[model samples]
Structure formats: C-alpha cells, structure tokens
Target: MQRMGGASASLVLFLLSFSAPAAPIPAGFVSWDVTFPGNSGSFDITNQTGPNASTFPDTTFPITTTLHLSGLGLTVHFANGSTVVEPSSYFTLSADGESFNGSPIAIGGTNPLPTSATLTGTFSPVFITLNNGTTQTILSSFSATISPSAGTTLADGDFAIINATTTTVTGTPEPGTWFLTVAGFGTLLGWRKKGLATFRNLLERKGAL
Candidate 1:
C-alpha cells in the first residue's frame, strides 16, 4: 500500500510538471541593406510595425496593403561625401507586387547634416513572390533622391538602388519560458524514475519478482 501511494504521488507530480501553459513568442524586427550600382553610396532600413508578430501583413498575392511604419529608421550615405538620417515613413505595396511607392521621408533633422531634407521616389518591378508562405523578394528596384532644404546641397543627387536583400523577422521563445520548459522535463523524468523504482520494490516484496 505504501509503494502504491508513492507511485500515485509520483504520477501526480509528473503530470503537474507539464501543467504550465507555453509562453508566447515575441515579435522581431525586419531589416535590409540597400546598395547602388556604380555608385559609392548606400543605405540601411529597419522597420517594425507593431509590438507582436500578429501585426505583420499576409504576403498573399492579389492584395494591396499599406504597412504602417512604427520605429522606422533610414540612413542614407550619399556619394557626395554627405550622409543623412531619416525617421518614420510609410510605403505602399501594389496589388500586382510590381510597384513600391515610398512616402516622403524627412531627413537630416540631426547632426552631421543639420539641415532638413526630403527623400522621395518610386521603385518598379519590386516583384515579391512567396514560396511555401514565405516572402521571396521585397524590393527589386530603387529610384529615390534627396531634396535638400535651402543652403543644403549635401544630399542632392539622383540615386538608383541596384541591389537590396530583405530579411523577415520570426518570433522566438523568451528566456524564462525556455528555463521553465527544461525544468519541467527534469522534474517529470525524476518523478518517473522514482515511480518505477517503487513499483519494482513493491513487486519484489510481494514475491512477484
């Protein structure tokens, strides 16, 4: 009877170890590098739309969506020895995945450039296709330039983006969640071993072993 009670307790403990719900994965940021062909300038872009992964738009075709930009940053390096930093701006993805119309992004509101400027233009054949529900391409062409404010000719020249590679963000489990998962498995294994030992001893004492 004592062995049976111990076995039952161990079983309960093992079950309880896995009772905690799994933690939700946290959202990540999307980023990409922009470079121009036969030019000495480049730029980088990073954007996060929401606090979680659920805010990402579905990449399915026949859909025209405007992704709201939150925490958007753009850094432009001009060939004329000038660099400009920009803030949050929005863009539109055409239904056919062929056009990328970027909204005017305000640049040079900070140091190094000091004067304000506007960056604007359109990219064509930005063809985006999905494979197994994953985005294959983001921006295929880039046609944009900076329109500097008065007395600021630092970043004033037509720029053509020759190459761009995008990286989509994926969610990951939190550190605490990983710890809990490991601890639970450890407790379950310990309880299982203890239960088996008790069962074996009980059988031995009862002349069944």
Candidate 2:
C-alpha cells in the first residue's frame, strides 16, 4: 500500500510539473526598411500603449512609414515626410499636387507581411475619391520594397495578415518549440517514475530489516 501511494504521488508531481504555464511574450519592436524610387528609409511597428487612444482591435501595432521624394515632378514640390499607415488598412501618397492612398501591396500572399519588399512599378489607376464619396480614377504609378528585421515572419497572424498573396519568407520556425517541450517533459516523467520505484524498494528493504 505504501509503494502504491508513493508511485501515485510521483505521477501527480510529474503531471503538475507539466501544468506550469509557458513563458510570457516580451514586448519588442518590429522594424522594416521601406524604399521608393530615389528615396529610402526605415520605420518601426509597435503597440500603442498610451492613454486616450482607441484600443478597438485590442492587439495591433501601428506602422509609421515615411518617404522623401524630390525627382518625381508635381505641380508643387511638398516637403518629404512620413505617411500614417492606417492599422490593418492603407496609407497615402502625394503626386501631381494631389494625395492618393493605397493599401500595402501584398507580396507573398493575399495578406500583408512584415518581410522585405521591393516595389518597382507605377501604381497606375489610383482613383481619388471626392468629398461626396465619388471616386475619380486617375493615372498613378509607384514602386517600392520592404524587408523586416530578424526573428520576424510575413505570416504571423498576430503581427501580420497571411493570405494567398503574402510572400514567403525564410527563418520561419517549423514544428514549433511546444512539441519539443512536451517531449522533454514526457521523458523526464519516465525517469522520475523509475527513480521513485527504486526509492520505494529501498524503503521496503529497510522496513523488513
């Protein structure tokens, strides 16, 4: 009866060890380099943890992408600056004395990724929507590419939008660490059970003496 109780206690301890929660995800910035014709720069995507800000999505990182343009001829050359990327939405550009907005071009699949991208083409047919909600189609063109920093992916749904148009990226971890962790715990449990059995036998021999 004592040996059986000891074995059961050992099993409970093994199960309890595995029940501990995983490590917390640390806060970090996801940086990317955005480039355009005759201009290049970098930006960061980070969570908005400030007060008085809308937290509808609950979990979202704001990306502030900026560009410096000069060679592209417009009616009036405005100072180069950053464009506020609407979270999970679009961004705006200026050309020919007017502003045009577009969503990030999906590279790998249908979703927007944080991986590096090189856009080199005229974003033709960008229409300007009027105040009355009527869109006026115009001739437009743009080309640029973006690439993400280390330990990032273009397919992370929590950080990115993954779809058919999303581009594949390297450094994507496969067979995630969870599997390895569980396997390790399983092996440990087996060893612990054997050790406890040997301890029970030792105790029994001592009692008999």
Candidate 3:
C-alpha cells in the first residue's frame, strides 16, 4: 500500500509538471496592449533603445530603435466568432515603433500611400527567442491589408493622415514545437496507463478491487 501511494504521488507530480504555467516575464520590460478591428494582443519590449539614433536621408528626425521584445501574445478574432491564438512573431520598428517602411511585416501595410486602396502582404521569416534560450519560428506567414478612408492626406510627403480601422493578420507555428508537444502527451499517456495497470494489479492481489 505504501509503495502504491508513492507511485500515485509521483504520477500526480509528473502530470502537474506538464500542465505548469509559462514562466513570468522578466523585469525591466515594457508592456503594451494593442487592439484593432480584427485582432488584439499584448507584448513586452525592452525599455531602452539602441545607443545610436538612425535618421532618414534628407531628414533629421532621429529614430530611436527599440532593443528587444518578448512575451508577444496575440489573438485573432474572426468575423464568425472564432478566435485563434497567434504564434509569437518577430516585430520590427520604423519611426519610433509606430510606423513601417516597405517591410513584409509592415504594421500599416505601407509607409506612404500614394492612393487610398487596400494593400495585401505577408510576414515572412518571423521568429522569437523563447525563455528557454531556444529560437523558434512561432509564425511563418501572414495575410494583411490596409485601406484608407476618404479625404486622407499626406503630411509634407512623409507621413499619412489616416485612421487604421480594420486589419487582418494570421500565422501558424512551426512543426518542431508541435512535434515535441505531441510527443510529450504521448509519454504522459504511457506513464498513466502503466501506473493504472500497476495500481489495478495491486488492488486485485489485496482483495480490494
């Protein structure tokens, strides 16, 4: 009976280990939450920027580059009331992290909109470093679009004067993590089956089954 109790306790501990929560975010990281028409998410960025400020050609506006980010949790809410937790993807900053310039992961799809129309693109080569020191590609590609309302204007031929009402972004996780997750579940199942069998045999021998 004592041995069976010990085995049951060990099995419970192993199951709890698999169901443990994620690690907490480190200190000194700034948290941000953004919500648009189609999706909402939260992320944490390093509080400081790079040492040197970058500037555009023929302009003197100093652009401070953000250092790094982690804990990027995103969710995509579809029109049919379905929601998907988007994988953590690498985000780039242009113009103080508020704008994008021709990159595939552009927040607004494009920097300077010559005309008001819907633009579509994808986010490629997106990856994030996990807390375990493993670099994983949480998101592979995305389909996004941006449409400007009527009477939108450009300021000094540099910035766009428009409101981003709705934007759609989507992505999928890489296969490596998925495989490991499946394998872990399989191992847990095997352990559970073996433990139950042993417990049953002991109970039968002791006339308790």
Candidate 4:
C-alpha cells in the first residue's frame, strides 16, 4: 500500500510539471515568409517594419498581378510623450490569408475606429505590378494617417503614431490542452499501478512479501 501511494504521488508530481505556465511571447518580429497562390516567385516580406507599402524584393511578377501590402506593426504616441507599441501577436493572417492582418486600437476623446472608406488601419494604397514590370498604388479615395498621437481629437485625427512590421505572437495553450495532458498521465499511472499489483501478488505467492 505504501509503495502504491508513493507511485501515485510521483505520477501527480510529473503531471503538475507539465501544467506549469508557459513563458510569455517574446517582443519583436516573428517571421511570416510564405508565397500566395498567384505569385510567380516567393513574396518575401521577411523583415518588414510595418509602415507604408512593403513589397516583394528581387522577384518580378506580371504587371496585372496585384501584390498589395503585407505586415503590421503600429506605434501610437501621446502628447505627453507616452508611446504604445502594438505587439505582433495581436494579429493573425487575414481570412483570405493574403492581406495584411488588421486590428484597431481605441484612442483619445471617445475615439471609435472607423470602418468605412477611412484611414485608421491601412497606411498606404495597395500596390500593383504594372504591365511594364513597375509597381503603382491604386489610390483609394480614402486613406488615413498611420501616425496617431494623444490629444488628437476623436474626429479627423490619426491615432497610429507609426506603422511598423508585423510578427507572430506566441501564447500559452488553452485549458483543453491541459485536460488532455492530464488524461494521458492518468493512463500512465494506471498502468504503473497494475504492474506493481502484479509484482506484489507474485511475491506473496512465493512467500517473499
């Protein structure tokens, strides 16, 4: 009985180790280097410091092919000289998996982010490779300032201080992951207990325990 109790305790300790909190996501660029379906070459935006329109370097595509902007890193400043750096982890790839991941932040004076043809998210026009193998922006009737700061009025104001590169944000697993892990550990403990019981029974029959 005592041996079985010790075995059970050991199993509990092992499981507890895996349940410990994961480390926080590191601050800075997380890479997202991938090619889209229609691209002729690998669309490299490897180290974008999210601002303006980042485009693929070296690789040339047909003029009609539109290779718009990629990456998202924003810096918001306040009149008081305070700054907020948007973490890269806050974004995931767009649903189509081809556009920049867009997220909005609330700013001064009852500022709610606008959704219409406005400037709060995208900093520049989408770039298209021209038929001559040169790039041009399809200027939208509406574009907003990426540089937003505090004291900027809620109306006609830019809140994003700087548009910068985007990266992946690593985070901890959910409770469901822990639950599955514990279940696996329970199976291991059960097998160990069964093995111990069988050993004990054999020893008793041999008059050894």
For model 4 the TM-score comes to 0.25
lDDT per residue as tens, model 2, 114-170: 443332222222332222222233223332323333444322222212101111212
Candidate 1, which segments miss by more than 4 Å at Cα? 1-172
State how far residue 97 of model 1 sits from its true place (Å). 2.3
RMSD of each: 14.7, 19.3, 15.9, 17.3
Q: Which of 1 and 4 is ahead in TM-score?
A: 4
Task: Give the per-residue Cα lDDT of candidate 1 at 110.
Answer: 38
lDDT per residue (tens digit) for residues 57-77 in model 4? 512222234323333443444
TM-score for each candidate, following the candidate numbering: 0.24, 0.21, 0.24, 0.25
TM-score of 2: 0.21
* Candidates 3 and 4, the one with greater lDDT: 4
lDDT against the true structure, per candidate, is: 0.37, 0.32, 0.33, 0.37
| Candidate 3, 12-119: lDDT as tens digits | 554443443332221122222232312322232323222322233411212232223333333433333444454444344435443222212112333232221122
**Model 2: ten consecutive residues of lowest lDDT:** 160-169
- The superposed Cα distance between candidate 4 and the true structure at residue 1, in angstroms, equals 99
- On TM-score, the leading prediction is 4
Off by over 4 Å in 4: 1-63, 66-71, 107-128, 131-209
